[model samples]
Target: MARLAMAMQQEKKHQHVEAPDGGWGWVVVVSLFISSALVFGLLRSLGVFFVEFVRYFGESAQAVSWITSIGVAVQQLLSPLGTAACSAYGSRRVVMIGGFLSALGFILASQATTLTHLYLTMGLISGSGWALVFTPTIASVMQYFNKRRSLAMGLGFTGVGLSSFAFSPLFQFLVQLYGWRGALLILGGLSLNIIVSGALIRPLGPTKVIERTKAKSLSDKYRSFFSHTCEYFELSLLLHRGFLTYSLAVTFINAGYFIPYVHLVAHSRLVGFNEFQAAFVISSTGVTDIVGRVVSGWASDLRHMRSLHLLTIWSALVGLFLLLLPLCSTQGNYVGLQLVSMAYGFCAGALTPLVFSVVPEIVGKERMVGALGLLQLIESFGGLLGAPLSGWLRDLSGSYILSFVVAGGFLIMGSIIITTLPHFCSCTNPPPLSPKDTKNEFTEEERLKQVLSLDSTENIHNTDRIPETLLSQNHITLEEIPLSAKRTDDDADC
Candidate 1:
């Protein structure tokens, strides 16, 4: 009791409450928003320049696409490595360095005269930079909040939507005015915003102490590295119930998520809409995505909702929207497009943070960084495969009807898989018990009585019936003790 009291005192003395808002935390959010805008938001607009790049390079669409695809692939593949670096060093330095590299990659790509040069500069280097910037930004935010985490994440992710709205027109204007080379140069300069943002992400409160405590001996570090690396490369997620369900669900949902973005403009043209109308359809998604992210986060916090349930419900709605999209092919169908865009955007936006939030829930915060990295790697494969497959299906058939149908089918399947999660219905509830039914079967009071009984019979301590005042003074609760003197053992027998 004395030792426990001492420990509690020490913890209280060392612990600090981070400013729930304002201070360095807000600075980190701003920095992350900028970085996110550069990476994810910029990536969202890549299709805007895809055709131009294909023509300029005199390459097939498939070949030119490899540039963007490889960049995405590298970003996804190196996510765990980036997470490991953040865990070892700090988020601030990692993000700063990543920003520099990313900007440098774009600048170099602007000078590239060959496809190979573009691949090396834009794909590999820029991709790595993005991975570094993104992973740490997420980690830094997670470190800042516990109760308001979902809201914080929502605000941070809103950058993507905001950036899409701002950057798409900007990029198109720049490409038209200055050509691809000059546009790359301008965008490269813009990437420096990431560095400035990264610099602002200082550690908050006791997070520094926690990071220091995580440092291990050399051999222990090596063992930990090997274990994590194995986990990263392994397909063992298929064997883990929670991971399997998450991965499969996400795969299905993502198949639908990107297809709309990829084909929206083309579909608009097909339906006899002007280029601006098509762009408007894509941009509308961003507006709704921003709204969805913020609203969903706030709602999740208020409702104390499980992330999976929210994800499943939203994804199911998105599936329904996709099914309805192809039905409206006329000028009147623009309303349908708007509705589908908003619904899809809402579902995808909400699902992003909710998915990451669940990582900490499943494996605990200690392993969360690693888990997120692995999950990104898997999901990236889905992103890479889904869009092109949809495009190919469109080409093989005369229309996008079958393509969208397949995409909607995948979304529904994903939603169903997500709904099957054990804790989807009850975020606060413990998992189901096994045949023994002993792990989580007892009430707190019952457990306390059992402990008190055990202690009384063994006479483990010199003191008996320690008063509530003593327990309170020592920061111990009555629940910690089991009394043996109780007549009925029914509570303890389980």
Candidate 2:
């Protein structure tokens, strides 16, 4: 395993191409944009329908909440499988199938009258579709860009915010006008955009080249497949020092990340704000999220510091703001929340790209698809449990204060873990070169010239050109070469 990793690293060092930004790449970006917007936007807007679903079904808040939560959990947990399918069959196929599933799920959901049906159609099918769509999209993006990868990924993920902003109100309007069934049907129809977007994404690189290099013989292919499968299940990442640290830190960070977003509206109401004011706080957070993503992308590219370090610092600051959140329960508190929200949004925006970026650096580009899949699979557990756990704390304590405090504590722990990463301080240093003695050795031409001189048993000395201090210090003797041999020596030097 170590040998394979080393070989993969060496291959990556020499083989990477600086990504081209225009043409088909732009087409893929546009496709990804539409796809991301549709998938994430639809997911985010579930809260809009949450209350209606609860009242209509006569279910408890926790029961109806499972509809969206289960869907999200399914999407996240299935990421590795979806990614593997993409690797085996092709991203194009996976995405197309995913789109179909998403549309079908939503349509099936429209006919549902019971929780079981909703779970099958919305939670299982739609969630699986999301897993298929999201995993492949990220893998494809990595294949497309190198230098501009973070920026591109940031831009692409902004589709989530775009969709949330545009669709939330539209979905609300649809629910008001056409009942939940009609609204779901409309959403199902709109979900076809995934299929169209999937169609737009042709395979990005030399698929033949990848296949040829990775699997030469049938036996080799079988072995490779088995090995990959094993790696996936074992999560070799747990053994990697940097990856383990990052994973643990991120788990803690994520444990707190969603709390503010989840409770922003309720928190606003608690402070005596009207519904419109509460709604505006959510809207403002989304708007700021857009701005934050863009700015963070630019900063990540332009700044000299390591992106992970920047992300860690920002995350810590965001956590600190969360710690201060409980103190603001008045009108002054609402204003404070908005400021913190914007700051947190900006930091969180930057943190997303950084989160995925480190995987490629830690593992190699070759293994990136698998690594990212596994990473998300693990982190999804954090996402799945974070908010509800916070809510549980709220239930236990009769206040959101302790929950926020716990969230802050987790974020701080995450920051500390991130600070311990080896690469955090090594970004300024170039990679260590091999043939260690080469650091102080003469040039190849000079070495060759010296070796050539040994054949004639003559030392070619140019005391005039050589530094006098070095010759004196070494107390070396110089021998003169014949004029005929000097020309030969010059030719050899050339």
Candidate 3:
């Protein structure tokens, strides 16, 4: 009893210290920047190699399209497992193991003579590795900051755009110089840098301090397993109205999101643009995409603006710009295509960071690990099939025009759905605070901070909504904890 009490007290003391949001957290941001570069950069630019595979394998367009789709599917599908592993083990161990697997998969892929062999090595193995690295790294960024979370994520994710710009031309050059196999070998070497990124992951969230205890009976063990699984997966978040609607919007947004990345260059080629001009359109998108991410993030942080409104605006614009792609193709001017590409890129980049940033607000950050995992798990289906859907449309229509239109339609639908967020859903919730009450008002983040400031036993049951005072003495898991623990008893504790 004495030892357990002391351990609990120490744990309480440690969590009270606010996250060092700007200090070593910046180092984690840098690490995530490199990671986003490698993961998204590679995924985005795989189109440069799409033509080569079609030529060499004599495969149909849809058949060739499944290669990248399978990788994306595997990456998104396994995000829950990645979160569970990060929860059980530390982020560093899982990510380093992931890095090794990624490198090994690519190295093996470089020697593959069959498409199935590419699917297994490159799609399954390397994609699973990406899951392990991506889930925990982004979760850590959300955990490490409150006020500046969007800005931090914006800075970190800018790597994707910057890297997409560099890698498109670089992969084209590598393919020109040494063939696809040589390019895969060099990329295999580059994927190992995730190990260095993994090294920089320092666990930043709530501390899990276990007491010395004995094993349990069979029934008890099974119960423990189920409990831990729920904790890891956060199935309870399905109960939150805000989270459900936002996740649904994400599903639609994701259904349309990656189409341009996968098909824009090929679309340019179909429109009579030369190799450099086609790649240049993608590169221009990358540059403005970087600018949009930073600017949108900074805007979302302003006093009166709601992040959801900004998110809705950006998503609507992503769809509108994608709809303009076919029109740009019709124009057949290099500068016109580049301008349209930049417009599409800017909106897409603007919404990407807000996608993750708004989740902590929807569900309290306390339940984020499971909520985020589930969000990705559900969104994986969209990521998996969106490209193939485009390819299938391409085969039928004999042009990429119909495909871009379908993609744009889904994004526009997503924009409509996000307007149902809490701030807009009901008459009760106000849109913004006046400058006078803003200081006195408590945002959800502040409310959570106040709850966490309580002693651990008391804090456990009061995560949501503001509490007038601590009202319970019991320590329980999140599933059992109420939004407020208000009680009638005044002197229940000594």
TM-score of each: 0.76, 0.76, 0.84
TM-score of 2: 0.76
Alpha carbon deviation, residue 219, candidate 2 (Å): 4.3
| lDDT of candidates 1 onward, in order | 0.66, 0.64, 0.74
Q: Candidate 3 has which clashing residue pairs, if any?
A: none
> How accurate locally is residue 66 in candidate 1, as Cα lDDT from 0 to 100?
59
Residue by residue across 1-494, what tens digits does model 1's lDDT show?
Answer: 45433433443343333435445666777777888889988877766666567678886544555566667667777877777676556688888889988899889988988788888988899999998899778878776766777788888889988887777677767888998888888888999889898888876433322422432221122223333333333222233467767876786776567667666566666677765676777688888888888887887777566766776787887787778787765555788777777777777677777767666665444345566777777777766666666666766775667677777888899889877765676757355233243222223223443433422232224233232111211222234443211111010000
- Candidate 1 TM-score versus the reference: 0.76
The candidate that achieves the highest TM-score relative to the unseen native structure: 3
Off by over 4 Å in 1: 1-23, 58-60, 112-119, 205-240, 398-401, 427-494
Give candidate 1's error at residue 112 in angstroms.
4.4
RMSD of 2: 13.9
In what order do the candidates fall by TM-score, top score first?
3, 1, 2
Q: Which ten residues in a row have the lowest lDDT in candidate 2?
A: 485-494
Residue 16, model 1, lDDT: 32
RMSD of each candidate relative to the true structure: 9.9, 13.9, 8.0
Estimate, for each residue in 69-120, the C-alpha lDDT of model 3 and write its tens digit: 8888888889888887776666778888888888888899899898998889
Clashing pairs in 1: 451-482, 452-481, 452-482, 452-483, 453-482, 453-483, 453-484
Question: Which has the better lDDT: candidate 1, or candidate 3?
Answer: 3
